[model samples]
Target: MNTFGMWRLARKYDKFPTPEEKPYSPFNRQEPQEVFDGTQVYSWAAGTAEFAHRGAVLLRPLPEDPAPGRWLGYKDTVRGPALDWHTDLGVIRLVHCGDSKAATDVASAITSNGNKDGVVTVCALYGDMGFHGPALVAADTAHPGIEYEASWGDVAALVGQVLPWWPDLLRLPSVIREWKPDAQAAVVEVPANDNEKILCRAAANDVFDVTSRVAATDMANSIRNNQVDHTSHEIEIFCKDGYSETPNQVVAGAVPDTSHHPLPCDGDREALKAGWHKLALHTHPDAVAALEVAVGREPNLLPFGAVTEIPVRPGTISDRWTQRLTMCDPTAAHAVLAQDDKAEAFFIGPLTDMPVLRTPGDDGKQVWRFYAPLSLPAGGPELASVVLHHTLWVITSDGHVHPAPCTPTEHLWWGDGWGDRASEAAAVVDQLLDDLGATVDLHEHWNAPKGLTALFNEEHKKGAELTRAALLHARMTPPRTR
Candidate 1:
């Protein structure tokens, strides 16, 4: 019989004002009774009549006046549908009573709503009376939507559950940078070579290789000079010197150690002299001296015999058999050597033996050297020729090559990996090849022993009919005049 009991008693009648309505005081009453429809229906009764210090009780009017003779018994206040059990109003009304027993009874009555209907009710029981201040109690029940069913601890947990989407609800700035198409637009300028402009103009697309254009210019120059003519009587060499069956051939007379030094019996001396002159003009004197030592001769002396005919490309002698050799362009020497069938097994070898007399160190130290030919094949009687010398020896007890090693040109492109600039050059080559209607598979030859020939054979076998059809189409089409 407290505030909550009074509220329950007030809510029982259909004529009672909703809990949402404001309370009104009766003319004679000290405490206010909530009113509806201008009727003074609800009232508080002193609970001292029922139990001491229990505060006041509440009563509701009976539906019909009490039956004539029989004494009318009052029933406990019945909850109504208008009372939201999930809300804190019912709980607030119950727990605000002055007496602990009354508050406990009110809490029991609210919780009992679960049995009457599906609604579950709960109440906060403060341990200390001081904590049950009016403001604190009102604050707990202030929000209309949330019901104060349980203790503060449970309320905190409920708040956390209700606020689950709070973090997701907040606005966040984008982490990724927004790039506009126009902002990214830029012009890349390529440095020009001799024929770069011409190639770029002739290119079907805007893209062209500046370096390849230079190389093509050199090639065109060579063609003009009759150096690389298909009709030229160029000697092709197939050599097999038995040191080890390595990929690159070992140069004769290049090792300082004279063990298996090949003499300058043929055109080797002139070739050696030419290679030295070529190298001396471009390289440092110390490097030239190193080259001479590798060739088993002084820098001043020539190594080839006068009677032997010196071909631009030196032939290899395996068991006294000689053949013609085809020379590689100086700029493309490394690429040519790397792709050569004979130069695949071992990483080290001499490019040309005739022009350079290279030797291993006298003390059995490993050394290799290159000599620029005295007369370049392009300018001289020889169309194209140069010698490469390789020297191999055992390492000293300290695991170092003796007689000091010779450094090759830094500009030579021999290694597998290239920097950004070289990669761009290779890409240009690929693009040019594509435009020329050529399917250039450089890696296939690089990986296999038979090289490009083997790849061509494989492709021919696999796509013979397709290739024939392409050929037929080519024959039927008229050549376009530019």
Candidate 2:
């Protein structure tokens, strides 16, 4: 005769021998339909089977050292994705509902056993699954889920204790064999695509402390939430779609603002002979007026011009090196398609306060020591149509046009990149960017430039890598309902 009660384990285990002391549910779990897996046992009753049911419960009792007290209880099992990977893999799960960070803590604890004697790997879910199955299962109301797999040796580690009456769940159609390739003189490794990632920042818990899985719903909600009301603390978003947040609006996959970037030093040349993208100097009103006809410049941001050589600095070529910073007449900016050379190619950028000035000790500064670049607008017609999208491009020069991409905000359009000129322009832009610590592509060929692949610093690199993660999040996260 068998009796049923609360079969409390001193600690967590794989199975038991008889009818569970605690029996409230029924033995109804059918094994995975695809395969007759024998490794797993029953879900509710104390029995092993060629296949395990869906609601398989497992025990993970508290340890003695920490004195879990009332917190220690039966650990629930996570089933394979009910719908698809949209839920989670069919790996083992361990749910804990303790506090706000309870799920996170439990995930960490479970991860500790990964690759252990009986564990294979552990991971957080792609999204938080709803609870309609059973209690004591490891899960959150609307948080992330944890996924872990048992070693082949213990593939049935999630099955309840194997009782004498339990059917054999270990005779699976699948075989768990070790993969051992013969030693090679040189083993080749395959490369994984670096573009994969989540596009949203973690607004909540961090399961892996690396990249948190968010649902598509959460991502759209996050975008709208950021628009309606910004949060106090939120991680930065990756711009796989070329996202740029402006003062008035958030631009996604649009043109970057180039009306005017901040310029200080009041165009003071002496103080900017090396690098002073940081030194603030008021921008001269005359310079602003000259640039206004072509581009937009920030009202503030100007302490003084760092390259003070007349608001319209002229470009000069010395010893095959060009120190070009000339203020061409706004009328020369453009004409009717056939009026002139079309003057359509524009490459806008910041004029280094210390153009042509080389810091003797600075290694990166050597290139500019020889060639001074004539920065131009980034817009206008081009040979190879490459770069990200921005705003509407109206003819801003020729009396009807304003100096864009090249305004005080961005300097006005000038500079030719036909032959060596383009290469020269590239060098100038590079040095300026290096000095200013500006990350993002000066080339602007790829609107959605992959993260740090084009960046130089750690912060920028980290951000780019996170974009892959964010892309994942954006794709996976669902739209918020309420």
Candidate 3:
């Protein structure tokens, strides 16, 4: 039967009559009355009820250590060993309230084997025995005592004994698997461009580290296989669009003859000769100035005034003074003008300080002349043009004017190619502008005779004002937002 039915049976038989029948309430009032002490019986019944309802129950020992103990009892016929029960309360009892047949069989086995001992039972005036279900059945080994019908309440008392070894059994194997490291390779994609070319070149030369070798090789192969074909195809498609192949080397065109003769030198002849030879080889547009310097005498070889007989300094050359005249008309006039011994020599002037002007005489008048500075400008005119965004004008003594060339506008397929062209143009423009600006300033201040001094000063003032205005305008303009 179920646990509830057993509980109902226990309740019915365990009750007593009310106050009207005995003139007192047995549970709530005092009276001279007879009573039966069934605390152990009730305890067993309560345990049985618990066991029958719950299949298993945890048994916590005194010290709370999860260890095995001695068997008290089990559901009679399950054929398993009787569970061991241990607790700080000395010894505890477990009553199994399992199936009735199983309980009876267990009782018979324990009784037949004569293993039952230290067991007890209780009896009362009863008809139903207040037991409605099978529970722990203890066999009488010492004596055949009154047979008590166990209830579901008795099974609960035996739960600890029924599963005492559960904790130990559960802790058997605690091995866990270890994690393995990931070993997958990573992939990288290379973009088609000049950078790819550079990378490939670096890889070919083994300039990159070993870790990067694989990536570099892949990029190189990709460039060789795909980019090569693609570049060729693009070149073919753009061929008809006026796309010209850039020349690897630019040829120097027929430049004007602006070479200078060295000045007459009063220094050691051998040293002067060697200096002139070296200067001539390195100098452009001023070979004449160098020649005159090697001669060790004033260039005014003409029988003129005291200026012609002026004694040259120990290491000074005559052309050094004469070359200053070149700036007056750098395009055509070839004449020595006044000289400034304190002139700050820069770029190409260490060998010869003065620049002579070569004039082209036309119609019995010097109209065109080319100015050659003994020293090149500190920062060349090419760089100045890039910074200033202004064209340089070269004026000759014979009234000839030449403007520095502009950069060519051409599309380049690669950034390196474009940068190369820009750098080259910038350098050329810087050189040209430096030379022109120096020449113009030198001619205005140091050339033109004293009679033209006022006119030259006025022109210089105007040029200075214009330069200031341009600079101010640049400073005031708002920067491009983009």
Runs in model 2 with CA error above 4 Å? 1-50, 53-366, 369-482
How does each model score on TM-score? 0.13, 0.20, 0.15
What C-alpha lDDT values do all the predictions have?
0.24, 0.22, 0.28
Residue 270 displacement in candidate 3 (angstroms): 21
In terms of lDDT, which candidate is strongest? 3
Lowest lDDT sum, 10 consecutive residues, model 1, at 163-172
- Which lDDT tens digits does candidate 1 get at residues 324-434? 222323322222222222221211113223322222333443222233221111111210111111111111222222111111211111113332122211221222222
What is every candidate's alpha-carbon RMSD to the true fold? 37.7, 25.8, 42.5
Rank order (by lDDT, best first): 3, 1, 2
Top TM-score: which candidate number?
2
The deviation in Å at residue 204 for candidate 3 is 45
> Model 2: per-residue lDDT, tens digit, 1-482?
12222234212334543332333345746432222121122222322342222222221221223221111112332421111011112333322121243433444544544512222122222222212111122331112243222121121222221100000111111110111122111211111111111222221323212211222112323333332222111101211212224111111111122122121113323232211122111132222222222122221222221121111112311211122323222221111111222232322223433222222222322222111122223333221111111110112122121111211222211123232122211222233222322221234422222222222111221112222233233324443433
Measured by C-alpha RMSD in angstroms, how accurate is candidate 1? 37.7
Candidate with better TM-score, 1 vs 2: 2
